[model samples]
Target: MRECDPRIVLGLHRSRYERRILTSALDLGVDAIDTSFNYHGFSAHTALATAGSDLLPRFKISTKVGFFPTAGQAEHSLDPDRLREAVERSIRDLGRAPDLVFLHNPERSLTGSSAAAQDRLGMACAAVERAAAEGLCGGWGISSWDPRPLPRLVDGTLPRPDAVMVRAGLLAGIDVLEASEALAARWDLNPSQLWGMSPFGGSATQPLWGKLDPRVFIQSPHDGLSAVQATFRVAYWLPRVGRISVGTDSPTHLGELVDALRYEANLDNLSTYRRLLCEQRDRQPL
Candidate 1:
């Protein structure tokens, strides 16, 4: 088995939850797995326990809550009682408390005025925070697909999350990158406290990946790394996140992701790219 590397997380958001993938992850040093209460049709935790209860302890597990089953449909909720119950249920299903659990897009249920949103968000965070404190999980966090409204709601009164996960990659727009940064700053989070997800905008096989040469973002453009690997590596600098959650069932594919980390990102090009993104955003109609 390879030494564990925490940087590359095996995200189960779009996973098959196969036993082979879990074993492959352990072999490749990608020991951290990110999943959710509602994944695989709300059976993710049980599936994980069934597939690799023995391997679960070997991996650092992170998961999400906030979506519940309603009449056989998934519904978003921030009700503290419901959220608290979910955390407990997650522990039961996984057969172990998760190392970290996120609010799972609190922004989805955050509708109405800013103050109302703030109130909803604060209460929801507090509930998860209490769960972590109670040993229901190791820690609590916030995972936002679109973090635009979160920064403003964070103030002295809101319960602080241990970490934050946001979308990262070349596809992550200026609005998302800036908002994620702003939220991190508001919470006084270091780079390590921030995690990124959906590095390929949900899939690497998209036609857009064929159009753009991702090597432009790498410092050494001729190292024989595939463009998909280059795009994954560049994701770390897109918003300066320390850990990125990527999903792949193939061990070969997982090894490719781990190997991509060896290449250094061209910070100068990334800086220039961010500047261009901001400039273009500024020119757009609000």
Candidate 2:
């Protein structure tokens, strides 16, 4: 399978100005766009569809399946029939096949036992493969919230993944932070095949630094870099992190991120920031 552009991925979550954000990101040379069937009542995919065919070919498109959004409560199911229907709906909604389709938070769909989860995952994988074979998608993967099952997936104990998306960032407070790094090294996968979600530590609404401990802040200022830039830099500079997904409706915020991607963090400052994160992680209760 071909790798996504290594620089940045524009995350299209539920937000205002969804179309504008996507267009601006493409204009700024974002390598890919990430969205799911449930984002913004499925308007996220519709926005891209409305962008016309010409613009669609410019960037790689990725969307997730298995989760359905509704008025009262969100729905989660990985039934093969449901998955097939989702894939078809996604293709129709986007007006084109996605470059990649992920099993959106498959962990949540688990019944009870590990064996049950594995069986469900296997069925989902088969469904995804059928989509790929039918040209509805070029490839498929797991947008995993949990990392425990990844080693099995990557090692061929489960279905092979074309890519792996996980919540990863510089902040120690985020779940799966260390596990993501460890998995990247241990898995038989290229950095380009590893997609880092929430490089800013969380969604745009709830940022990682919102409740961060003051001591975790960089004691020394990183020259010409904002705290946000510094934080993004840590994930961007990691050798094993291929694509970092950032979602924003503000063009100015998007521009700042684009600029930040160009500025390499000073190695000394980066080292200190990493050390602080490690210390914070050590202090956490197991």
Candidate 3:
């Protein structure tokens, strides 16, 4: 894979500030934009369509398939026909084919027997492959909320991803960092091929920087950096993380993140912080 600048992928969730956030991200030189077919009941893609016509060629675009949000709840089904419809709808809604299309969250679709789960996954993967071949998408991947299927992917039991998005962060409480490292090694994949989402654990509810203990930063070499900056550095500095996706509606907040990326983290200090975070997690009760 060709190496590029460390990427900041803007995540477009269901927010009223979609246009503003997308515009700000483009101005700040974000390498990619991630959205879903069902985000804001498909309004997210429409927003991108309006703003991204001139900008789409400048960045990689990724979206998810297999789920559609409704008034009451999301309709989830990974039947091949549904998957194809979803991808086609996304392409139409976004006004361009996605560079990468992902299976929204296959784990949720898995139930009952392991054999049944495998069959479902195979069908989904096949649908994604067909989409890629048909020019609906450049490639296919998985955005897994659950890591259980990752090992199968790594070991060749499941389909390999052109890109994999998983939750990872500076906090040791997040297990995907380790899993990502191992999977990358097994597949000989570059960091760019492994996109790390939620660098600050769960950006939606509790921002990681706010939850971090103040004492963790004490005795650190990167002392001048704020907790948020330090957190971004740690995630950015990870060897196997090619891109970090952050979601925020404020242009000022986006600018702050862009500025933070300019500073490099001290390796030794980063290691120590990881150790401290692990210890903190251990101290918590199960």
Candidate 4:
């Protein structure tokens, strides 16, 4: 087996939940995977258990809660009791507790006045925190697709997460990047305590990847790197997270991502790019 690489997390949000990919991840040294309670029609945990009950123990699994099934449609909720129940159910479905459990886009359910929003977010975080304390899961985190609403809501009183996962990549934009950093700082989290998700903003096949030369973000002699691979490498520095969760069912593609890590990032280019992003974009495009 290949030695485990701590940096790459196989995000199962878009996965087919196949056994071969799980085996491939282990063989490729990608020993971590991130999923959500609501993924794959809320059958993700069960499917994972079914596909590779034995393999689950080989990987460090991270998953999200807060979204639940309702009347055949998924709905977001921050109710403490409901959140705790989700954690319990996830353990039952997966046949094991996840290594880390994220609050899962808490922003989606945070609405109303600022004070009210803060209260809701804090209680939800506490519920997961309690689950972790009770051994319902190994640890707790907050995975935010859009982290803008979070930094402001975070303060000393809020229950800090073991880590915070946010969007990272050329497409992450300046606003979310800064917000993720700010939130981590408020919680006194170091880089290793921060994580990145959706490095390609959900897909590597998007038209945008083909148009840009992402190698600019990497220190040269990297002419051999593919633009897609270059983008994955640069994602590590985009928001400066320790681990990044990306998805793919193909083992070859997964290997390509692991190989991209050999190239070092061009911090100067990344800095300049961030400056330009700050100058032009104050908000993410709708």
The CA lDDT of each predicted structure is 0.92, 0.71, 0.71, 0.92
Deviation of model 1 at 25, angstroms: 0.5
TM-score of 4: 0.97
- Candidate 2, residues 4-93, lDDT tens digits: the string is 335788787745634566667766777588889888776667766775456777778899997876676689998899888999998888
The candidate that wins on TM-score is 1
Comparison by TM-score, 2 against 4, better one? 4
> Which residue pairs come into collision in candidate 1?
none
Clashing pairs in 3: 191-242
> RMSD in angstroms, candidate 4?
1.8
**How do all the candidates rank in terms of TM-score, highest first?**
1, 4, 3, 2
lDDT of 1 by residue, 26-65 (tens): 8888889999999999999999999999999989999999
Error of 3 at 5 (Å): 4.3
TM-scores of all predicted structures: 0.98, 0.81, 0.82, 0.97
- Deviation in Å, model 3, residue 23 alpha carbon: 3.1
Better of 1 and 3 by lDDT: 1
| Model 4 Cα lDDT, one tens digit per residue, 141-164 | 998889998889989889988999
